[model samples]
Target: MVVVGHIFWLSDFGRFAVFGFYILSGYLMTYIMHTSYGYSSLGRKKFATNRFLRLYPAFWAAILCSIVITLFWGSSSNGFILPTNLAAIIGNTTMIFPHWMPSQIEPRLSPATWALTVELFFYVAIALGISKTLKRTYIWISLSVVFIVLSYVMNLYWHARYFSIPAGSLPFSLGALIFFLSKQKSVRYIPEAILASPIKLFFTSFCIAIVTSIAISQSLSFWLMEIIFYFCMAINFLLVLSLAKQNTFVNGLSTKLDKKIGDFSYPFYLLHYQAAAIASVISLGKVASLKENFSLISCMLTFLILFIMSLCVIKLIDKPVEKLRQTIKAK
Candidate 1:
């Protein structure tokens, strides 16, 4: 959704899809900590190391791609600008200053990286034991609520929605709450409404349709839309991740296919702008202006190049990094 929204429909919903990623991240990191990396000192070290390994190598490669594209084959549509100052360059490369800080509005080579800055913040929080105990997790969730309410009251809700480090904890902490709920003793008897994947999918789709219909008919409040989007998308992602645990044939096959496609996600997220730039360069000046003359052919070419570039990064950088991550994780 982020890729489609950014690459093809830049005017629409690409940025909101990142909230779904935050929820998914919270759930996944919680599961990993409980199952493999415990709350011990050594475990904390390993967890932090593992998370960096998971993100940084591909991220750096994407930075390289972005730099090359900006210097050699820049495009106007993807907003690919190389930061001229040393500080901005360092901040962009290390993802240290992608926030909404007024004094530090660093030139982002890849616009998608601001969310990654948020992700790294949560990674540190998780490693610091915010997600360790159910009680602590609840505290984390409470912080999210407080931040949301305060931001809304102060008229900073939308601004804080994506880039405000403190307020952005809403989705991450909500995801942790979901993980903690599933682990409760009472969850063993969870209603089939949520436990069954088919039912989960159906109910989510039905609610979405109902919501869309209602939204079309009348003005639904912004909060209502936010609630619906977060609840629906979080569970939907959990369903996707849980497919691997299912014994059914279709579900099992879906998991296998999902794992393969998942590899493209990170690389594509980081390198997509460069892909667009590359497409623009290759279009023989046809894509001079995305607003007027960017053809369907240009869009498809961007997508194709994105996939090829992502696949190459996965094979060349991500695969070897994965092996090393697994080896370290095994310890």
Candidate 2:
């Protein structure tokens, strides 16, 4: 994934994957919150507890490891520049430094924690009852569109630092809309069936064409490209969800892998960049050089090492934290 990011500058397909995550989040959150568990069952306290368990433990572990690696083994433009200020270290440790105030220390540690900042904001928004008020499918969809537009506007005009809301968020809203639509007993499941149908082959092909065209075209602005990418992502997500429902074989395979990887994905994504940065230092500038053919090989090795490290992190930190949360909630 890191290799793709480095190689294909125009291939922002990973961002599209983030969009798929958003739609899925919306669907799953809505189903769990509104359908399986009553809205009254989830107050702000419960919401905060859930979000904290889901995020903070693994995050803090990754941050600490990254800081240690940087301090000891990391390379510098000149020699090692020790992180001097207590404020900077505290900011990175808390994950509040990049979100509230910009800092030079951001590039040094886990840069991907920026996405966690967006995610934390989303959690706060949902917990505060903002998501609860968006009852209708249309309203949720409209709000998503509005947010995207506002994000673009902020990016274009105001130079808002965090204008590009992670794509994972939109999926959550989309999922909410799906959940709402599913509840209306009168609403036929035919649309979903069609989405799930073999006819999706055509739609998938068309989406591919559109994506290719946009990638080739230099005239489209970054925001416009983002819009196109999200639209394609939504369609692709619908197709994938539909197919998953209808195809038992596919469903079975997906279910197994999803169970294994779903929760761990966040930790993997967050920690992978840190792993890459450290690998680059250890490689002695060999990892980052476009001229070196071995850089690709180094990156692949780095990704594998990071994946193993993330799995260990998940087992050691995340699982224990989760168990502790469950115990507290049970009490």
Task: Say which candidate scores most in lDDT.
Answer: 1
lDDT (CA) for every model shown?
0.70, 0.56
C-alpha RMSD in Å of predicted model 2 compared with the true structure: 5.0
Per-prediction tally of clashes: 0, 11
Candidate 1 per-residue lDDT, tens place, 1-331, comes to 6676565543325544566678778888887888889888999899988888888888888888877776775545455677788888887778777545421364677767877777888888887889888899889889888877887788875556556777558788867766667654444444544545644564564456455435734766767766765566655555533432341424446766868987888988888777877787788452343334468888888889999999998899889989999999998
Clashes of 1: 0
Cα-lDDT of candidate 1: 0.70
List candidate 2 segments past 4 Å from native: 1-3, 6-11, 35-42, 75-90, 97-108, 133-137, 147-172, 184-190, 197-224, 236-251, 254-257, 281-296, 329-331
lDDT of 2 by residue, 1-331 (tens): 3233433233343455545555566666555554333455444566567767777778777767766665666543311234468876775666655533232344435655655555566655555444564455566567666765776666654223223443345565566666555444433545645554534543573556446555745565755665566566657556545543443424346776766776667777767656655566566653343223346666676677678878888788887888877765554
